[model samples]
Target: MYELKTKETDDSVIEFIERVENLKKREDAYRLLDIFTETTGHEAKMWGPSIIGFGSYHYVYKTGHEGEAPLVGFSPRKAKISLYFATGDPEREQLLESFGKHTSGKACVYINKVLDIDVEVLKDLIRQSVTFLQELYPKEQR
Candidate 1:
């Protein structure tokens, strides 16, 4: 498995969010931080240089590729807020259909504003994604 340094939760993530160009977007980023931490019971951590991630999981594909990724995360990108999580199983696609006013890019869901989506629905999406991943690769493997 490819090894990555275990990420530590830090206040720098909040500082980074504060630096977002749009005030409303910055607030939305912080709100996502709160929801992710509260629901996942994992503090926010800066991933690489930009992504604000919560919890983590280690993954090794059958092809022998491996890496560690956040259990759930988001970034306030210049174009839109990019939400991150596993997109596995059929039910996840069902949730995405009802997720509202958002675009999916690869594995990340791009939303312009948190106000554009249902907060509770977003929470359920995150919860289900995390649970689905856990079933495939438990926390102990992370």
Candidate 2:
């Protein structure tokens, strides 16, 4: 069986943010914590050693691999802040057009800071990601 390395842990989300060595990144982490919490209406949780996640959902792949994952989350890494969202949400591409400065991968969006993006658009992305994941892996199925 394959183990999920980034499962939720009983770590302190605040302490993790406080420990971010970069002052700017630390401040951005705090701002993101507030924004994600307010938008998701869910408290933050430590996901593995780094990620600060909100609500969670269980996902089972077609291959029978399954795991729990946060509906949305972010990590203030050394290079940039990585925002986690649903990978298959079509609206994500559309919204990112107006999202200010950011780069993205299949499942994560990278931003330097909150001030560089439109916060309203950020909120929309957060809501869409949560809705997308929740619908894909419905709570009743979890």
Candidate 3:
């Protein structure tokens, strides 16, 4: 059995954000906190040590792996801020076209700071991700 490392913890989201060494990154973390909470309509929670997550869902893959994960989240890292969103949505890719100054991997979008991206597009991405995930795993979302 594989263990999921990113399980939600009782850690303080504000403490984690306050520990961010960079002043701008720290500020952006606060901004992102507000954005994710307001957009998801869920209070922020700490998913692991660093990730500030909002909302959650349980997902079971065809391979029998299942776990709970955030509908949306972000981590203000040393290199760049990592934005977590649902993967495999074509609409997400389309929104990224206008998202500005960000690089994305399979499941995360990395940005230097909040000012580097369009906040409206970020909001749309958050909205679309929540909708897509909730619809994809309707019974599992809470």
Candidate 4:
């Protein structure tokens, strides 16, 4: 059996943000924490040692792999801030067109800082991911 390495932990999100060596990244982490909290209407939680996450969902793939993951999250990394959103959603791609300067991976959108992207677009991404995941895995079922 494969283990999920990024399970949510009872770590202090503020302490994690405070430990960020870069002053700018540290400030942006606080900004992102507020944005994610207000947008998702859920308190932020630490995923693994790094990720600041909000609102979790249970996912089960057809291959029988299943686990809980944040509906949306972000990590203020050394290189760039990584935004986590639901993959395989066409609407996400559509919204990203106006999301300002950023790069995308399989599941993460990387931006240098919060100022580098549109906050409204980021909120949209958060809401869309939360809705998509909630619908996919209804609360009762989870």
Candidate 5:
């Protein structure tokens, strides 16, 4: 039984943002908070100690491993902000072409700040992530 380390908690999202040491990152965190919330239509929740997540869904793999995860989220890290989105969406790569300056991994996109990326593309990414997850885990209610 593997445990999910990033389970959602009752931690204060605002306090977490306030603790970000960098002034610009702190401000970007606030802006991202608004973007994710408005785009997903879900209030932010603290996932683990750092991730500010907007919505959630449960997933079970073919091997029987299962856990809950946010539909979209972001963290203002020491080096850069990490944006979480659903993986395996081909459209994500297409959108990133015009997303301004950002780097991405399988499930996370890294950006210096909100100003460095196109906010409209960010919103589309958020929406696409939520839609992709919901479709994949259709029975799990958010």
Candidate 6:
């Protein structure tokens, strides 16, 4: 297992938020983090270099790909904030339609600012995504 180097990491989650050049973006990120953890009943951890992640699931596909990953996470990218979902369910695509100003990658939703989206709506989306993952994968496998 790879240990988290929290102390030595300059971009620790807290410090990263503090460094956000935009105030609204910073506040929104923090709010989403709180809501995501509460709704999913999971704690958040810093994944890889910058993603703030909550919950985790282990996945092995028919192609022989297998790995454990966060069920939900976000990166405060330079151009926009990117929300990640490992599963690309159709319902999630529908959610993005009404999710306010955003664009989508295969499994990432990109948002420029929190003000561009409804906070409550975002929370609901997160809840739905986690629920979808749990249903698709067994508890042990997830």
Put down candidate 4 lDDT per residue, 78-115, tens digits, no spaces: 99999999998899999999999999999999999899
Q: What does candidate 6's lDDT look like per residue over 30-84, in tens digits?
A: 8777777887788777777778888877666788666667778887777899998
Give the runs in model 6 whose Cα sits over 4 Å from its true position.
Answer: 1-12
TM-score: the better of candidates 1 and 6: 1
Best-first order by TM-score: 2, 4, 3, 5, 1, 6
Model 3 pairs whose backbones collide? none
Q: Estimate each model's TM-score.
A: 0.88, 0.98, 0.97, 0.97, 0.96, 0.82
Global lDDT of model 5 = 0.92
Please give the CA lDDT of all the candidate structures.
0.84, 0.95, 0.93, 0.94, 0.92, 0.76
**Which RMSD values do the candidates have, in order?**
2.6, 0.6, 1.3, 0.8, 1.4, 4.1
Clash count, one per candidate: 0, 0, 0, 0, 0, 0
What's the lDDT of the predicted structure labeled candidate 4? 0.94
Total clashes in model 5, counting residue pairs 3 or more apart in sequence or in different chains: 0
Candidate 2 residue runs with Cα over 4 Å from true position: none
lDDT string for model 5 (44-81, tens) is: 99999989998889888888788888999999999999
Whole-structure CA lDDT of model 3: 0.93
The candidate maximizing lDDT is 2
Better of 1 and 5 by lDDT: 5
In candidate 5, position 68 carries an lDDT of: 87
For candidate 6, the 10 contiguous residues with the lowest summed lDDT are 2-11
Error of 6 at 1 (Å): 16
Rank candidates by lDDT, best first: 2, 4, 3, 5, 1, 6
Superior candidate under lDDT, 1 versus 6: 1
